[model samples]
Target: MKKLVKLMVFIIALYIFLEINNQWLVVTEHVLESEKIPSSFNNYRITQVTDLHDATFGDNQQKLIEKVRATNPDAIFITGDLIDSNRYDLENSLHAVEAFVKIADVYYVLGNHEVAINKMDEIYIALIELGVHVLPNESLVLERDGERLAIVGIEDPLMGMETEEMLNIALANVPDDMFTLLLSHRPERFDTYVAKDVDLVFSGHAHGGQVRLPFIGGLVAPGQGMFPKYTAGTFTENDTTMVVSRGLGNSIVPYRLFNLPEIVVMELKSK
Candidate 1:
């Protein structure tokens, strides 16, 4: 009987600890090197913000912006789910969005929440006005020195069209000699991006499986069931590298256990 009581107390303590840890924000840094990188863009930093879900770290997301500003990023990439669908509040998210725009060039892709909330048109229009490169099956070119790189964004599959079809359109105009960066919401479609010969891809939506178990990785994710692959970290296939952020917010899972919010920073290095 005493052992049973002690076990119960331990479980309760563990739950409390996990809840507190989930609120803590963290920054993850990585360096991506490739011969394809241009010298002019060497050491170029990119801050990735994903799955905000209307969660504010501080007033108007001032704390979050401060963290990003310290990175001195050349650009900010928002992979998706900037707002929550069930809550359906844009004003809160827009404040963070507005702050992000002031930092650097921002590129965004659509997430499932954006479509589920049914505010796609309104959100896209507002973002476009902010000079954000909100790509929906589209591509944009950034030039450094005499070299150019392609940054493409794909819409979420919930938008009523096949993702592969949209991918074809986005990559159609990319030049053969340029380095390509694809912004996709789902990491599960990594093979599709690899098949297209994309140089690198940034993705979120798995939320690090919401509850990671050390070496076991994420417990479950939306699209990928139990023990889903590609939950976080860098994965390679052929010539493409996919960096999946654990993400900054949660949706299906009420609280993340062992999975904390993180902002991923990538520095491009020339090999």
Candidate 2:
């Protein structure tokens, strides 16, 4: 009887700990240096928020906003999955974006969830009204000290378009010598980004494999399957570097094990 009681207590304790871990926000900072990065843009900080799935972090997303504001980012990027398709709630997710736009220019690209919701027009209009740049297979230039840097964003492949074709369209006019930063929702397409010769990329979709394990990393991801690579952190292939956010919130898998929600703060350095 005592052993059974102890077992119940242990299960309850583990549940509480995992719940806390889920809501506990952690900032992962990365300093990316590349000779291609313009000297004028050096030390430019960017805060990335991904895979929110409409999960609340403090009232009105104050906790997430405060954390991003604390980073003092020059730009804020929302890679994808701001809201969950399973439970559509754009207003709830926008609470963070409302605060984020006030802190810095917010750039966003669609994720699989958003595409599945089939309300791209509504979502785009809402974000645009809030002063967010909604990039749909397009490129925008950020000029600093008369030096040009391209920021390219593409639609999620779920929109019935192949990622390679999308990249080709987005990069059609971008100069070969230009330093390009691509915002893509799927990290599984890292090879495609590298093939396009993109200098840097920001992506999130794996959700840190939904459940992480020590040494083995993310246990499972949507695209990468079991023990997938590109679940989190920085992955480099040749000259292209990709930073994948572990992301915030949960969807189908209601709990995250040993995987704390994360906000990636990246600073660019001209090497």
Candidate 3:
């Protein structure tokens, strides 16, 4: 009985520690050897945030913003799942958008949750109104220091009606000799992008398995299901690279174990 009581106390203490320190901003840097990137565009900083899910950001967000500001990111990208639920609440989404707007030039794509909540239109408009560039199956070119980089955002295939056609259009304008960054919510569609020879893809739909196992990896992932392929972190296929964020908040299940919430900062380097 005494041993049992001691074990229980140990478990409780461990849980508290994980929850309080769950907020971690992971910074990952990668370099792509593409003919398109201008020689001067070698050290571009791209900050990425995914799966906020309307949970309390705690100090993670503020610290992330400060870090990005310090890095002087060339641009910011949010993959999806900004809200935790389908039901729209103005306060939470708005607050998230406002906070990101103050940090850097923001661009976004919708996640499955955004569609499930049936508030994509309103959320899209709200984000744009707040000076965020909403890229729904579209592409934009950023010119700095007389050099150009192609940034493309694709809609979730599950929700967007003309996802395939839109992807074609978005890629049509990308020059053969330019570095291309594709923003997608689901990492499963990597094959499609690889066929098009995209340089890098960013995604966040899997919450790093939600409940990760010690050495076995993620136990469950939404959409992808058990033993999900792209739960969190970085994956590469052929020459195309994908970074799946563990995400910043929880949904469906309110608690997280092993998998802590994260905001990803990726610096693009030239090789």
- Which is the leading candidate under lDDT? 2
lDDT of 3 by residue, 1-271 (tens): 9999999999999878777546654555554555556767777778787887876554444665565566567778989888766444556656656767877789999888888878889889889899999998888988877888889998876674655666798888888777889998888776777777788889888888888887777878876788888887777777788888888777777777778776676776665
lDDT of 2 by residue, 1-271 (tens): 9999999999999988988879999999999998888999999998999999999999999999999999999999999899999999999999999999999999999999999989888899999999999999999999988998999999999999999999999998899998998999999999999988999999999999988888889999998898999899999999999999999989999888889999999999998
Question: How well is each residue in 1-271 modelled by candidate 1, as lDDT tens digits?
Answer: 9999999999999888876656678889989999998888889898999998887778888878888888888999999999999887788888877878898999999799999988899989988898889999999999978878889999999998887898999988998778888899999998888878889899999999998897799989888889999889999988999999999887766788888888889999988
In model 2, the worst 10-residue window by lDDT is 207-216
CA lDDT, every model vs. true structure: 0.88, 0.93, 0.77
Model 2 regions more than 4 Å off: 1-8
TM-score for candidate 1, please give it.
Answer: 0.93
Off by over 4 Å in 3: 1-15, 24-35, 59-64, 67-72, 160-163
For model 1, the local distance difference test gives 0.88
Worst 10 residues of 3 by lDDT: 56-65
Q: Candidate 1 regions off by >4 Å?
A: 1-19
The C-alpha TM-scores of every prediction are 0.93, 0.97, 0.87
Better of 1 and 3 by TM-score: 1
